[model samples]
Target: MRSKTLGKIVLSLISVVSLGLGAAGPAAADSAPTAGAPVAGKTEAAGKGGPEGIIGGETADSSRGMAALHRNGNFLCSGSIVDNRWVLTARHCLYPEGERIPDSQLTVRVKSLNRTSGGGVVAVSDSRVRTEHDIAMLKLDRSANAEPVRLATANPKVGATTYVFGWGRTCATCAPSTVLKRATMRVESIDADDVYGGRAIRTSGLNGRTCHGDSGGPLFKLVDGQRYQVGVVSGGNAGCPDDSGFRFASTPTSLTWIQNVMADF
Candidate 1:
C-alpha cells in the first residue's frame, strides 16, 4: 500500500518534547558521543538546555561510525540496526498523520538514503500501530552487516549519554542538509504532566531536538559493545527553537513491546 496524498499530513504527526541542557559545547564532545546533544549545526534554534538535557549534534563530523537507515543516499531520518532483519521506528514515519499510506508502499532502505544504491536495502511495511505502542518495525529487503543492537530490558539511566541519527533538518533557515544528521540527546525524565506522555509512554531528553524531514529516525543507547535502539525520530512543534526550543521523545522502551511483531521474521 502506498500513500496517495502527502500534503499537510506530515505536520500533524504525534510529537513528544523532553529535557533541558545547560552547557557542554560541541568542542567538548570529543570522547564519547553524548546520548543527547544538540541538532547538528543549530543548537541556537532549539535554544540552550538544562544540565542533564544533552545531545550529540555533530552529524557531519561522523558518518561512517553512525548507521544509515535509508536505502538511497539521503532521507530525513536515520535508523539503527536493531536486528539484522528489522529496524524500529515511529509508524507516523512512513504514514504520517492523516495520510493514507499502505505499508507495501513503504521501503526501509538499510544503508543507502536515496535510490541509486545496489538494492540490498530492505523495503518494509505491514506496520502494526498497537494500542500501547508508537513503534513500527521495518522489514529489510535482506540481512544486513548483522551487528544488531542490544535492547535493555531494564530501565535506561536518566542521565545516560545517547546518540540520535537521521536525515532530519539541520536548522530552520538552512536547507535540509544531506548525509546522515547525527546528534547527541541526553536522557532526562520529562514531567508526567507532559501531554504526549502518559502511563503507557515514558518520555525523556530534549533542548537541541528534531524537526521536519527527520521523521522515523533512531535514538540509540550504547551498552557493552552493542547499541540499543530505543526511540524513533518523530515530529515536533513545526520548526526548532519552539518558543523555548526544547522537546521530548516517546520512551524507547515502548519499542520493546513490539517485539512479537518482529519475532517471526
Candidate 2:
C-alpha cells in the first residue's frame, strides 16, 4: 500500500520544498527571482537534486490555459485556468500548511508558454483553499482571455499515459526554465496522499518527472484528442529522474469540492 502521509515518503526521499525563489538559483533577468513558502513538515536535503522541474522533458509547443503564479514579482508555482476568472493550484503554493497568503502578493500570467513574457498578467482578487486537500482556487481581478482547461470527472486508470507541464527547473541545481516543458508519466496509483495528506494520484515517470518550481502544475490526460486535467503537482522523490515516484492532488477525487468552490466565484 502507498504511504498515507508525506512523512513516510520524506524518510525515503527528499520532499519538494519551494520551487519558487531560492529553491532554484536566480531566474532569468526578465523575470523576478522565483520563491514560495516552504511546505510544512517537510525537510530538504541541502544541495541534493530535488523535484523543481521537468527532467528529460521537452519544450511545450503550446500551453493554452497554463498559469504561472508569482509572489511579489517572484515565480512561485504553476496553475491551470479553470474559468475566465478562476485558477486552480496547490494550496501549499500560497502558504505553509494552515497559513494564509495575502491576495495582494499574488499574480498570475496566462496564455503564454514563457513565464517571463508574452501573456496577460492579473492580480489575484481572492482565493479559497480546500480544507481537506492540497488544492486551492484563485479568483482573478479580471476575466482571462485564454480558454480554460477541462477538469476530468473520473480518476485516471492505472498505467494510463499522462502529460505534465511546468516552468520549473529542468534539473536539480538548474534555474527554472523560461519556457514551459512537458513530460510523460504513467499512472501508478489512484489512491495516494499528497504532501498535505489529501487524496492524490501517484505517477511514475515514463519519459520524465516533475522537479522543483513545478509545484501546483497540471497533470493532463488526453481523451478522444481532447485534453483534460486530472491532477495538480504536489510532491515527489528528491531526484526528478529517480524511480521513487511523484504525487499529484487528484482533481477528479475532489470534483464535487471543486464545483462547490467554483460556484461561489
User: By lDDT, who's the top model here?
Assistant: 2
lDDT of 2 by residue, 228-263 (tens): 888988877655547446888899987898898878
Question: What are the lDDT scores of the predictions, listed in order?
Answer: 0.40, 0.69
Worst 10 residues of 1 by lDDT: 19-28
Once superposed on the true structure, which residue ranges of model 1 sit more than 4 Å away at CA?
1-56, 60-76, 112-119, 173-175, 190-208, 242-252
TM-score of every prediction relative to native? 0.62, 0.83
lDDT of 1 by residue, 1-265 (tens): 2222222212422211211211001111122332221111112222232212113254433322233333122332344556666665555444433353464544544443321233244555445553433345666566655445555554456676665555444454332334444555665543221112221112233434555445445556677756565555543444444322223334444544557767855
List clash counts for every candidate, in order. 48, 11
